[model samples]
Target: MDAWLYNGKDADDVFGILGIRAEGSRSMNSRKLVVLDEYINLFNARYPSAATDSFIVLRDGFGGEADFARVLSMAKLRPESERMIANTSKYQGELFSKWMVEDMLEPKGVLSTVLEGGSYGTARSEDKLVVNHYNVFYKRRTREQ
Candidate 1:
């Protein structure tokens, strides 16, 4: 699972990162939906063997990034399916820790990802079995000048 961080401040920022731009009069949500659909379509074309539903989208309630991060880490997702999500929620401050990308369907054009948050699923050996769930957070990968 390759990790990418997008600066959610403007449409152009998103466009450059996702490789899609909105046409005349397209609302942000509409643009996002279009990107999501296109992304999924493109993704499906590459991985015919992986079932279609394996991909999931976690949209921010208000359409920003933080919410995107939250849903990205939800425990309900299947451990093996690849997920591609665009966070449209807002985030305050920065965050860090360990994240794992379990698989990469198409390593270049489009990527399908399996995320393991924080430490690997197991606790230190000889200790009681503890489910170490990694809390996912959005950290800025690029600092805009």
Candidate 2:
């Protein structure tokens, strides 16, 4: 497990000390989190046809990223899709400039993900599980199986 995680990433061999009794220190790095609220605005600007939708619905009842991305994948999307993709890529590049690549790059590209843990399904102690580690596993080699 340890080797799988640290194999190509831990260039300093930092993770190599995991099981050994070792000490470390830390400090706070100040960073300004830029919250992007331009989605609705940009959507409206780029897709004026969507303006008929209620603002309340747009604000409080935004659809899932999967739904958005799925629609975005359709072939005929025009000004809106182009603008959205361009702006999202811009935001990602901006974030990476201010932070570590590890902090900015995400599996879903434009969406943040939550971590999941615990045994997969109904696994016994000896059973090898093939859990979907989601973002992390997808970013690297398939952790499942």
Candidate 3:
């Protein structure tokens, strides 16, 4: 199972930009530990197969780092579990600006390339363009062979 978790304010905007709808809610503001526990429980329940994979996408500047830290702590508690954080930034603007070579623009080309292509693409586009302009973090628990 896969889930996209965004801050309440940006949820709708993100959905619109991605041309997809997501369940908008403000749930991560609760205790971080509680959220982590709930995530682990839900993951275990939803993906019972050892070979199945699950992921979560979180927006930066909205307690994303804190939530990722909690996931790391969860990994420590269960050595069999693994978690990783992939952070990125982007400068969104008109389509032409994204492909321009000019040094200065409304969304500076060089800045966009460095932040979006260099960091965001390198991290998230390893497989495919799953989500844009969002930091992706994932946890995996595998059964011992």
Candidate 4:
């Protein structure tokens, strides 16, 4: 199975720590919509047989409310950065949830289950290491009738 990770910040630094090829994208608004489309293309290209499975590791901030709030409380970020984070978190959470229910759960969809987990790493600044939580959504072909 192929695996990919998504985050708002530059992912190359933490890719080794997470053991996945991370792709950085806004994951909100219409700015980086193509990122998701690219991901779908990559998935299809990697799993051309239609019977293979893939994994997408998403930052918990993309869906976890409590975790996002906790990060906001602890991180010393600028006002604009804080607002952006909050907005993106809210938007991505709703979008992801909808995709999970309407798309992933449908027949022959390319998703099986979303599993939650956490990882420890330092930010780009490298000031200090912190726990970065995430969700790993497994994508696979649904059973054929």
Candidate 5:
């Protein structure tokens, strides 16, 4: 994770350049995740010390379920990053989307979540999302915005 964050060679390395900082904590199963402005990052670890990092870029999910489904479909197009997003860490296969919305309501995590039961329009896409288990304020690309 640090490698890509500092190297800037990998596709997700932009996080480092953007001055984004990642804060991580281990789940009961010892898994990790990193979410921030426009991104939902999930970490898969095989050993206690080693982990493979991947992320999903949040798109327009303001339309609720329809937008979530669309964002997920587009996420699948990313053969490399989609691997983690498709893997469910929670019951609804939401990848902690519920918590993301909560984070914003409290700790200012993501402005809103994009899953089936997520909140909408609490924030603008331009707002920076918080990092850790955590967080999307994706730009509005719709005609409505």
Candidate 6:
């Protein structure tokens, strides 16, 4: 099971660390957006990694399902440095949203992959970038009903 811990701080830090730039772009590709939206629904429907599931759901709430999904898709596709900035923005928005609603909840991890220097932030590592077994059990092993 791949994984990274986040304590909720630091833009450069991976895992559950809170970052600094949690408010950047919200716009993204429509097809990837659709894929991400479905991905979130799958996450919610499955009994996979409980830790990250709650975080993703909670983060979705902050930006609205659509907005969060866009950010998430972008983050998934973005390079590490770009993700550092983009995720920071998204995470910050979610935090503020939760605070304003007085929910006082936080996500477990902020999973992001490293990126090569490129424009669409499409650059990725040859190594597996997924941070948890959520990808394994849900995305690879499970069969669709």
Using lDDT, give the best candidate's number.
Answer: 6
Assess candidate 4 and give its lDDT.
0.33
**Predicted candidate 6 versus true structure: per-residue lDDT over 1-145, tens digit per residue:** 0122122221122211222124323322223233334444444345244324334543443345434434444555563655355544455345334432354322212223121124323523321232221233233322542
Residue 108 error, candidate 4, Å: 36
**lDDT (tens digit, per residue) of candidate 5 on 2-84:** 55434433324443443322211111111232333222232222232433333232212123333433333333333244333
Tell me each candidate's TM-score: 0.22, 0.19, 0.19, 0.23, 0.21, 0.24
Question: What are the lDDT scores of the predictions, listed in order?
Answer: 0.28, 0.28, 0.28, 0.33, 0.30, 0.35
Candidate 4, residues 85-112, lDDT tens digits: the string is 6544554445345545564533123111
Better model by lDDT: candidate 2 vs candidate 4: 4
Of 2 and 5, the candidate ahead on TM-score is 5
RMSD of each: 17.1, 21.8, 16.0, 14.0, 14.5, 17.7
Q: After superposition, how far is residue 39 of candidate 3 from its true place, in Å?
A: 3.5
Better of 5 and 6 by lDDT: 6
Regarding lDDT, does 4 or 6 come out ahead? 6
**CA lDDT, candidate 4, residue 112:** 19
Write down the TM-score for model 6: 0.24
Candidate 1, residues 1-145: lDDT per residue as tens digits? 0122222223233344553232211222344545655544554555555423212232223233222333333312322222222222211111112222222122111111322223332423211111212222211322221
lDDT of residue 97 for candidate 1: 23
List candidate 1 stretches off by more than 4 Å. Answer: 1-16, 19-28, 50-55, 59-145
The digit string of per-residue lDDT tens for model 2 on 1-145 reads 2343334322112222231112111000101001112333344455476442222221122233222222222211232344445543343233333222454434443232311223333433211111121233344433433
Off by over 4 Å in 6: 1-29, 48-95, 103-145
Error of 2 at 48 (Å): 33
